[model samples]
Target: MPTHVVFIHGLWIHSAAWKPWQDLFEEKGYATSAPGWPGDRETVEETRANPDGLDNQGIAEICHHYADIIAGLDEKPIVVGHSFGGLIAQELLANDLVAAAVAIDPAPIKGVKVLPFAQLRSGFPVLGNPANKSRTVALTEKQFKYAFGNVLTDEESDALHAAWTIPGPGRPLFEDATANFVRNSPAAVNTHTAVRGPLLLTSGTEDHTVPESVTLAVVKLYADNTASVTDYHRYEGKGHSLTLDDGWKDVADDVLAWLAAQEL
Candidate 1:
């Protein structure tokens, strides 16, 4: 039977960003989909045109949005996500909805204590403005380079930025960063859930957005889960853009190999 693989994209990018991965996964005999976030349009151009469409969407709303889509699928899907999307994969696994989950450079969920300077700088565009909590945020090219493309060539980074970047709602970023303080609507994961299928957390050593230390803390949260499999792996010289960078195929292949082990 063909596996159902659902790809979820993080903020500041459109679902089309996952097209290459979708094609690769499909060629491997898996059914694939890259769903858009709430209020996201069909294309990146459309999303960039009206950034306001994504404003005010918090983690709760976005998580439920993907959950509803998953509820309509024919089978439990293998969820692969990047950045904020990674957090969504965890959320779905918590609900025991996915066959397996892979989170690459996932944003800090509740209880992740390692917030490095790079992570904070990458998030400054959204975090700088208190009012941004209810608005859309777009990164400048320099910021994008620093956050995602730092490991790539300047030319490659600039071209990638131009090709695939969009505005994103900042509410989720705020919700995630302050999950500990806020009791309501925190994007918290149930690390001890035994019903969850296999989960793999991948990190890039060069990733500034979600550093390796943060991923270590994320793994610790699930350390007590003996019933389900949870593993963490890292790639040297790769950044937050491992899923979208030039070496994305190599990383994807490694992911498929690991997922193959899950038999999920």
Candidate 2:
């Protein structure tokens, strides 16, 4: 059976965030879907106005939502995710619901701790506040520059911020950063090894949001005991915006090559 692909967007964005990638994947004969999380806004204006609307959504519910979509597909999917979306991909894998996974700049999986300056700065807005756990936070111009736009040109970064960026829920970041939790989310506990399928970890060399060090930590933690195949790649001259940057097609093509190798 041909592999199905489900592209999950991270916090602040909705299913439309993956439109560019969806178009590229569809052309290559992979059936694709991009589902929105609960209370995800349909428009940028709406998202900006109500960034906290979905802050209460927990990891388990989101994981179950994606799993339902995967269950509906006749064939298991090769999940592709970025940032928090990457975290969700691992949760799906934990359920043994996917054939393969491609995590691009994925957020940290449990027990993986190599926080880079960039990630720290990107998360500072919420990481500093105790109340942020139940609220939303907007990335300021300066914060966004250091966190998400460190590698992009001034003009390009400004355009990207204006066009696609939205305020994001703070709870996940709080959960991701918190050292102790009684009720663990699937991502907060390292159980993805249950997945026997192939796994690929891709990180942008210039990606400050999820630096190489952090990606390495996640890879080592998850790949340690899994008997399945795993691989890693670093794209030079690329930043956190690898999905929509000038060389996005290069990343997409690289994934296609990797997918061809799997013959899924």
Best by TM-score: 1
TM-score of each predicted structure versus truth: 0.98, 0.91
Residue 83 local lDDT, model 2: 79
Model 1 lDDT per residue over 111-222, tens place? 8877899999999989988899999988888989999999988888888788889998999988988988876645788998667889999899989999999998999999
TM accuracy, model 2: 0.91
- Please list all clashing residue pairs in model 1, or write none if there are none: none
Top candidate by lDDT? 1
lDDT of each: 0.89, 0.76
